[model samples]
Target: MDLLRSLPLGLYLEQPVTWLHRLDPRVKMAWLMSILVTPILASPEWRFFLVLLLLVLTLSARVPLRVWRQQMGWLLLLSGLVLLLTMVMPDGLVVAQQPRLPSPAEISQLTEPFETLPPLPQPTGYQYVIYDRWPITITQRSLELGIRISTLLFTLIYGTNLFLLTTAPEEITAALEDVMAPLRWFKLPVTEIALTVTLALRFIPLVLEEVQNLVRSVQTRAINWKKLGFRGSAQVWLQVVERLLENLLMRAEQIAAAMAVRGFTSPDEHKVEWHRFVLRAWDWFALGLLAVFWWARLVWGGEA
Candidate 1:
């Protein structure tokens, strides 16, 4: 199993650079933040809109069908499962109410000419329970909760995935460092922080590679898992895990040594400008659209 190609989360797409890739990473970061933050306490309609918006963005960007199909297919399935589970679960809206009718003893004590009043009719056409059956009951609140949860899950994971897919690691670090420049006034090690982030991002692929290699090695050995039993399999995997950690540490040490050999002692002294930060026409247009997005959200996205 090729983990790199099969699971491409947080991995940037290098070929077929789309307009999304060309846009300033900083602007993309802002838009990503907007997509992630707008779902809080939002109406179900708004949350659904965000889900559609992310899908639209992915489609418009023309991301490879193979890439997004793997990413979104599983995510959509998970969201649907969550929605179904939530719909069947209790919504916590049940409350005890005093009966309108008096008890038999109390009724017997009533005045001589008293008669029972007619049952009152519902004033509105609203029904809280949408469906009822022997084993399953779905209420309006439960449905709303399902929609909210499913949409939020889709929005959070897919939104961040799209951002990472379009934006490169260098671009991400550059954008973050630029945005965090203000923290320098407080004597924070902004450059060092940026360097650390850059390394961390770059190290993801290495970690995946190590895992893939170890799994392939284990497969080539053709170990009889059925014969080995659970305890044997667990012990074998424990050794693999230990070796994986050692290899990762060695990789990190190699990277550190390479940097030192290249005369890179400190981040502030040996700063590497990965990408130039410049807002283009498309970026300004995106910012304008972002303003409109927020305006619409504030005006109509609140819960009923």
Candidate 2:
């Protein structure tokens, strides 16, 4: 878990071979926009784009098959974990609805939410549920749901790979708020959001550094190495933990000193200039097309 937690976002980001990374942020955003949109309509639907996504990542990055294979190990583990989680969660076992006694709220509610509706149907395996003698065939629904989830996972894997491979996490966070600036209407604080995101990325390295430091300290103190075997291992672990706490204290003190030196306050921005970011023409076209496609899909052929 620790190893996976320490995995760099860059590990997923692939180096682009084509014009993708070169495109204006917006154009690059739009060109592959349907990569996200098309799958949405794909309930029991498959997109050429899904496979295309993989091909694009593989081709553009020219990553070794082994790297993909390594991902596969995690994927398999994830698939199993998903299956298990979905199978065991609240309604996961039934995969459909079952009724329970309504609360006083439901009984006294002015809302007559349910009428003569039959007992909430539960999803039987891969559809084809047994409703008395009748069956609710949901093979398509089941397949689509699974595919939808798989595609989501695929996007995450590919997108993370795409981001880490090309730009630093700092850059991606910058892009996110910059592109999503329209949301400020609802009073979204994009800058703070970006700061939080950057800190989250920074936290990864900070944690790993702390672990390494602790491990090294333990290694240097070889006195306990020969004195205890299994017990010694336990003592080393305890020592590592103590050292980890000490490191955290030191870091906390450094942060305090740095903040003091800068006269930092909660209200001030980090004084970072985002203009240094490259927003090329291709990027603009890509983003524009993405918006247009997304609008068309939602307006003309919505999730009907």
Top lDDT hit = 1
lDDT against the true structure, per candidate, is 0.91, 0.58
Per-candidate count of clashing residue pairs (backbone under 3 Å):
0, 25
Task: Tell me the lDDT of candidate 2.
Answer: 0.58
RMSD of 1: 2.2
Query: Which prediction has the highest TM-score against the true structure?
Result: 1
Off by over 4 Å in 1: 93-114
Taking all chains together, each candidate's TM-score versus the true structure is 0.93, 0.56
Candidate 1 lDDT tens digits, 68-159: 89778899999999999999999996799899977888878878635878989999989999999978999998999899889988889989
All candidates: CA RMSD (Å): 2.2, 11.0
Count of backbone collisions within predicted model 2: 25
Give the Cα error of residue 49 in candidate 2, in Å.
2.9
